[model samples]
Target: MISLSKSIRWLFCLLLTLAAAFPAPAISAAAAEPLALGSSEFYYLAGHMEVLKDPSRSMDFKKALEAYGRGEFLPLPGTLNAGYGRNAYWIHFTLKRGVAFPEKSMLSLSPSYTNSVKVYVQRQGRSPLLPSSFSPVLLGSDVPVAERPVLNPNFVIPLDLQADEPVEVFVRVYSKGSISLTGQVATYGSLRNSTYYSIMIQFGYLGIAAVLCVMNLIFFFAIRDRLLLYLVLYVFTVLVNNLAVSGMSTLLFPNHAHLISDYMVYMGIGAQVLVFSEFSYHLFHDFAGLWLLRYIRFMSVVGVLTIISVSLGFYASVVPFALIGIIILITMLLLTSKKLLVSMPQSGIFITVAFGISMLGYFFQIFRLIGIIPLEPGWEINMVEPATLVHMVLISIALSERFRITERQLADASRLSEKRAVEIAEDMTGELRENKERLEVALAAEHLSAERQNQFLTMLSHEYRTPLAIIQGNLDILAINSENGGEEESQELQKMRRAVARLVDVMDVSLMQNRMLDLQVVGTSTIICADEFIRQQVDAVRWMWPERSFTLHSELVEESVFGEAPLLNTALFNILDNAQKYSPCDTAIEIRTWADGDFVMISVSNGIAGISIGDSESLFDKYRRGACSHDTSGAGVGLWLVRKIIEEHGGTVKMNSAAHGRISVGLAIPVERGETPYCQKK
Candidate 1:
């Protein structure tokens, strides 16, 4: 049997060889013309390495190379900074000054290392290097790189270094290539024939890591669910897997290697357990389906046991950590089983099944690692891509729920706020503005009454004298006739009677108009339906104006219209009487009624000889009659009173004059289409 050191070395060499055989970029051929010994100055590649050389151009590099005398290590420029893979060593060199290196590959390992190890070389502090960046031109003879590599002792990597100019080198050894610790290869942890397999696994891990990162971000936006806490853990798990599989964890974070290797396996397993705990908590509600929690507790206990196993020595330490993770994926399945029990709805059942399968995949992964489950290309490594993907999916589901709920809440809040704002505006305008306007109107009305009183007294001084004079004349006649007693006395008495009657009628009309205009309503806490009350006025007017021709009409009123019937009556009579006096004799006066959903419309038409139609608008003003109203016998306050009545009833009046010289008055009042109008308050 071989010695221990020799066997271990063989195992290492075998692993490196297999790793080098893994899939990676093929090495490129040297340029058509070799670089000469003395050529260019310096070349660079960003943040990695840079080199300068002299007499660096050559065809056969073996002759021109001023290689180090054997038995000495080559020094290369390097850094210990965190960004440059902290605490790592590299080989940096320069040809004699004034030379440039071209088309040089500092180190090239067997393709197997594409998975188990990675080699990146570039001129430091410059942009990225491409294949065709520079080429060598020969100015010197051959070199000694053709000898079989001596570092091929299984564990040692045989590095091929060549360049037209002196170049720097960096080498990395992957700790994840867990080949057999013996010289001979085996099935489960083989040292040969699986080099390419390891590299592909690493590449797969990177792809998975990228996917996990993308999915986590998406979920974060969508669900914002507390479950994302578990997703974060899963993302870490993915990162750890990538580093371990790529061997980067060992090269860049050597302090974390062993821990990271085991962490990949354990965290991948532990994430499932945590996920199950969270799922069970969310799915079955309370602690109702708590057997899984107990299982998790048991697994955690085992994990601690596994950690202690480490102190027992490397041989016995692999069990607990691995076992805890694989104990039961069915816990997730069971968590879902309860959901599938029909009491649960199927809204998210697809997600449940998918996650359940993911849990199984985790179990399969862990089982495969410890030699329990068998699958093609078997063996768990520093990578957990599938597990990462599953975790990502779960995270996505949670985020979707969060986003959907948030969107709905925002929409609802927006609608409610908008509605409230509208209501507030209506209240301000309808209540406050209306009340302020009413107060201003009240003050205005008081001022108007004072002005009207002054005008009334002034007009009375002029008008009363004529009637009093006529009365005085009539009284004188009566006195004379009574004294004469016997001649033409009857005829004279009859004529006097006629004059007195005309005077009395005018006074009565004026008094009634005054009561309607200046009457003070103690309160309006009353309900007087226009339909009922208007009929009373219609009948009274038809009787009083027996000689006046007018056709009165009323239409269907779905609801009660509010108004003070008595005041309306006086107002209507004045309008009618005025119409009678000015209208051509024997012309029919028409009264018509109609109501829209919100307003009651009443139009009174008369064939009266009046002012021109152009002056109709002025008729509604107090003491302002249309020019067509000339020669009418009455105060112009008649139509003005119509406007006042309509205003008090929360309505408007419009006058329409026909081309034929007839005039019509139309009134519109705000009346409810249904329900009784609010009784007016006194």
Candidate 2:
């Protein structure tokens, strides 16, 4: 449970920290500057060239120039530039034969200032690129080439012809930036391929979401854990975020392109908030995050509609859309900041913190963009930013811990099984050795042993009583269950459990008396509603066997104490459980708690006998049931375990007796100053 809570806490911290502590976006991101375009008008030139079926007839430098020399720009058929980041998209363009050159026959030029371009001529794995400025490709006609482009950053030289032989050409646009592409590009032949490639890359994340969602569902079926519900929501949010950024929705869901692109940011943000919030709430029992979560849910509805309205209203104009986007974005952010995970369960708070760091990184990007800070482009804010990756890694850690806890549990069980196996094997081996030694002396008397076994069986009265008692209780349970069991049946069940408990007590006491092995008494932890347990224990002792009048009192009642509530209840119950056991039928028992100097004392005094100051020290010893009372039912181990437990909790156990035979038992557990009466119980 602790391990589970911790995983949930880290995830919460990460998510909460993001929503709460995210730094404000930098100024530049807040304010967009109008980019003034230069005086050059865009030149859109169109032309066509034939694709050559034969490689021998392929265009080299001479053929391209020969075509260019005729009139129009030489057409390189079937060339492609798919997208900004990926280089996989194939480009197919044809050039007239002899357009390919050994030195400077044909050149592919990209504008030097293009922010999003990387070009390469078809080559095998390696390509020499040119410098940043005026970099143009000069194809070598002498080399045997493959189908891909030679990756070159520089494409500066001009194309010229060696001869007029007509040839076909093909080139590829590996990637591109905002800068202009001039000099030459052939007529486009595969619009379908280019569009499909863009769409598929955009939808890649949808595939990712589908996989994660399916896995989450499978996990839900297997584990039946509510965390999987949030996981599914989380995966869904990532898919929506991916869709908006990658532009798949623009292609596949074109009718909702403008709407989807604009509103996806809001959906992505809100969905992520929901996933993280839900995860934390179910994980941590704390309700501090409740109201804030409610607020986010309420505002999210408004934010979504506003996005749809504004985006639809302002699609043609960048200003209205951008301004509306900012308003909704800020509002959305404000809503998430309140609850997050940190507000409720500290266990899940790390997830929030990680997200917070990532948010800070984003704010930095926004600041730079808005001109609040000066930061380099392409190097500073990006998807690969350190903060973002770290956040994802933290979340992964939380996921891994869940698996780790389960693994540890399995490993522990396996170790216990192995230990038991070893013990069993040793016991069997020892028994065999003992039988062999006995056989050496008793081989001839083995037949006489049968009669001895019968005599031993006849002497079993002492050994059979406890089992007979248990069977007696079991028979009572059978009779109760045979009828429609009401209070009577419940009493029978309680008797059975208590019978089993008493038998355990006897075994434990006998084991201690024999001292067969070294023993370490481990403690147990239990939940307590402190006030109620104390009141009930005191009241029950006061009322049961009412001739023993008992008083209940409290100076400071810790409402909730985590350690061994039931056992403590049983210990106090032992006090009460014993006050009833020892009190004079007509005398009184006093129960009170008050500040006794530095200690808070909970003492139970009953007018009874069989206890003295010395017995206080030794009466709690196992199997030391005193003869001062007719209570043969007392196994004498109850107070021993009680003494051990309370002393371990840093408290003392004391006993007192009067000449009148009145007795009292007092147990004090140190209540440290300002210690949480109820720190969360493990």
Candidate 3:
């Protein structure tokens, strides 16, 4: 009797299952019917839904249908999220005809990270309540690129609807990485268009990543900055990870699709986290404390572990470690901001705001994965992509700020150095001025002593001249009285008189030369005719030496000269006297004067015996005598005095010597501007 009861209960359960599977026609039809709209319409499935999980992945469509009939399937959750797992997730939805949408529609499952996806569609006319009634189609990253209905990186399934018919769809998704299944329904044409634009945006993401990577790399090389170097590594790893996740790498590297698998994607993520953590640690080194340092080290270890696990084909295990690293990075950033607030509040506030905005897209994605944020259908917004760009921009700004601060410090140091140099230069300049003034004072004292010596010599010469003149007078009386003595005694008296006269001449010439050497004691000045002056000197020399002849020549112009007339007469007399003394007593003394240029020139030539042309250089030096003047009875002051006086009057004197015993002394004095007639004719 218990066996019979068990049989009856089994039959009852079977009948109940059968009844649920095949409801009454009207009710079944109504249950299968989707919302009715116009022809060729497109819409998301908005009716009752069902979802199933296949942990074992052994269940077929028949069992899945049976599970749905038994109410084992739950209402459609926000998304089909399996997290990072190997389990397959199935989502089921029913759609009815909607407002006219041209052409057949398509279903898209985003994002493209899923390893494999299978889509099934059932029409109401084909036993829609049964899973066996559905036709299955496949699209996913694992599906061969050439076999896809739409050749796009993301999954797209085609859907065709008949008039007034309800349609149902089931999507199964599985992946070795994080499983995110967001389903979207739209016209096939619209989906293609969306796919085109999506590709363009993905390329944009790639372009931005590439450009920023290159830019930061340039800065890294230029500045040798540790932060910039790590930043470039982080950006490059992140870009590779994003490409793998987006499945674009599969299309780009079709020949090497196996090489760019989910393992590499996760590996890249680990590397990105590792580099980024290092960057953060270095950037905030000034403000970080012990705990923060330890936290960074811990994260770095985890990041390394994640990379090892992913590389060893343990991507599933590395997901959690990657998550832990992310959490630590975020914590470190927040704490760093707090520390910066105490030291640099303004910069801290700005950085905090920037980090907050940049982190939005990243956290939102995480929230969506954990079901903390609802999954959005249609084109999934990648908050992380734009957020990453913003973060990179913020990093650049921070680097620039650091450079600016450094430059300002260097500029300050440079200015201080320049100021010190200028101060030293000024001190040296003052010392040099003092030294120059002392040298000038010493020079003035020495010059004064020389003038005193010259004055004493002039006084001594005058005193000797008086005594010598008296001796000459005594000699004249002796000569007259000696006429009574023998010829020998008379000759001795003549010789003594000549000796006395020569001594007197030497003393006079020496005194005059000494006075002329003193620049402060110049001859008294007056207007004098140069031609008449020459004649007076010539006539005086003629009277002194009657044994010597003289020739006085003149070419007078309507020109005058201002000077000490007596001194000039003395200079001319000395020249003529020397001409007669040095030459044969019978040789003619030639004195000629003429106007040459702005001055009147005088030439005094005499026949000298053996003077060379080269001897003219030392002819005017003090105490210097011409080579042939040794036999002459006069001091060498004759030509030297003429030169000094003419030079003082802004004129010149030069000596010319020739062969054949011919020598000439030329003198020129500048003519005065005021016109005057010659007072004495030639």
lDDT of 2 at 205: 41
The TM-score-based order of candidates, best leading, equals: 3, 1, 2
RMSD of each: 24.5, 28.6, 21.0
Residue ranges of candidate 1 with Cα displaced over 4 Å: 1-197, 214-224, 241-347, 369-371, 374-384, 394-398, 405-409, 420-682
Cα lDDT for residue 305, candidate 1: 52
* Per-candidate TM-score against the hidden true structure: 0.32, 0.27, 0.54
Better of 1 and 2 by lDDT: 1
Superposition error at 78 for model 1 (Å):
46
Scanning candidate 2 in windows of ten residues, the lowest lDDT window is 29-38
Superposed Cα deviation of residue 182, candidate 1 (Å): 11
Clashing pairs in 3: 40-101, 41-101, 526-563
Q: By summed lDDT, which 10 consecutive residues of candidate 1 come out lowest?
A: 137-146
Top TM-score prediction, candidate number: 3
Model 2 misplaced stretches (Cα beyond 4 Å): 1-210, 254-269, 283-357, 361-397, 410-682
Higher-TM-score candidate of 2 and 3: 3
